[model samples]
Target: MFQHLLVPTDGSALSDAAVRTAVTLATAFKARITGLHVMPELHVFTHRIDTLEDTQERYAQLAERHAEQYLAAVARAAQEAAVVCEVISVTHDQPDEAIIRAS
Candidate 1:
């Protein structure tokens, strides 16, 4: 009888199993699902003088793209399962912490 479900993914093949499982459960329960992709906090180590391989803007853009790609598959799975789904991406230092926050 779940009314809402939160699914976290990093776009790996392993995580796809979780997404499919969540989608199936959500569909069975007629629930809405929220898929989350947590990006790493890019600024933490970017300030190091030795790490200036690219600009902050470039790094942010690349991160955003990767996050979107990861979340997109979940959205598509939810769609196929006919479950209402919302996706969000955020940056946090620790993924476990971000998953807890999203939950």
Candidate 2:
């Protein structure tokens, strides 16, 4: 029996589905769930690159906002399902590393 579950979400439709499924499973199994969102690490070189429209600064801002939004959704799903959930986010260029650390 699973006592704890870790659910990582990106706020995409597919990711959302997975989060919901995790919540349902937690509710049924009477387990705890942790939601994680990893924002890409902002590299110094990334700022040097210029976009046709927005600058790297803008992109970084958007990424931060998106991370917050995605993590919020995870919390909402867990709450609606009446499942205990813990949420956290970190900046790591390699999302895999972040996930590993989170777990």
Candidate 3:
């Protein structure tokens, strides 16, 4: 009996499958779903940039956009299943850490 299910996705095919499974389980149990997408922190030091701040900003923006898109898809799936869903997007250097913290 799951009251709240935390589903982490990276927009990959495998992750999408996991989302479907989570949705099915949530729908079956009438549980609330929390969809999470962790944006990987970009390592700008590896690449030469005119300004580290600019590069970091660019990477953050890109990651945020990707996370938004991924979370939106999950939200749509949950909506279609007629399940309550919450979307969360976090940027962290380690995805696992973010997910663990969210859970």
Candidate 4:
């Protein structure tokens, strides 16, 4: 009876299992799934200007890449099950709060 499902993932093995389960349920209910990943906000302290910029840039790139990689699992699972899927990513200091907001 569910029209839409929200699946939060962190790229963990446990999370992967949850994604599969969610997909199964969505398939049964003919529902669409939304996959969400919350990335930690980067915190760094450096005196060198170049180092700070480099670190921030690198962290941003890595965070985006990781979010994509983590959400890809959900996308693939949904695709295999022929279930519609959407993905979202956000940077937050508190992941639990982010998830709550997303829900």
In terms of TM-score, which candidate is strongest?
4
Clashing pairs in 3: none
TM per candidate comes to 0.87, 0.80, 0.90, 0.94
Could you give candidate 2's per-residue lDDT for residues 1-95 as a string of tens digits? Answer: 87888988888899989998898899999999998988886555453445523655777788879988998898898898888888887888898
Which residue runs of candidate 3 sit more than 4 Å off their true CA positions? 46-49
**By lDDT: ranked, best first:** 4, 3, 1, 2
- Compose the digit string of candidate 4's lDDT tens values, residues 24-95: 999999999999999998888777777988898999999999999999999999999999999999999998
Please give the lDDT score at residue 74 for candidate 4: 95
- Per-residue error for 67 in candidate 3, Å, reads 0.4
TM-score of 4: 0.94
Better of 2 and 4 by lDDT: 4
The lDDT of each candidate is 0.89, 0.84, 0.91, 0.95
| Best model number under lDDT | 4
Give me candidate 1's TM-score against the actual structure: 0.87
**Cα deviation of 75, candidate 1, in Å:** 0.8
The whole-model C-alpha lDDT of candidate 1 against the native structure comes to: 0.89
- In candidate 2 the C-alpha lDDT for residue 59 amounts to 70
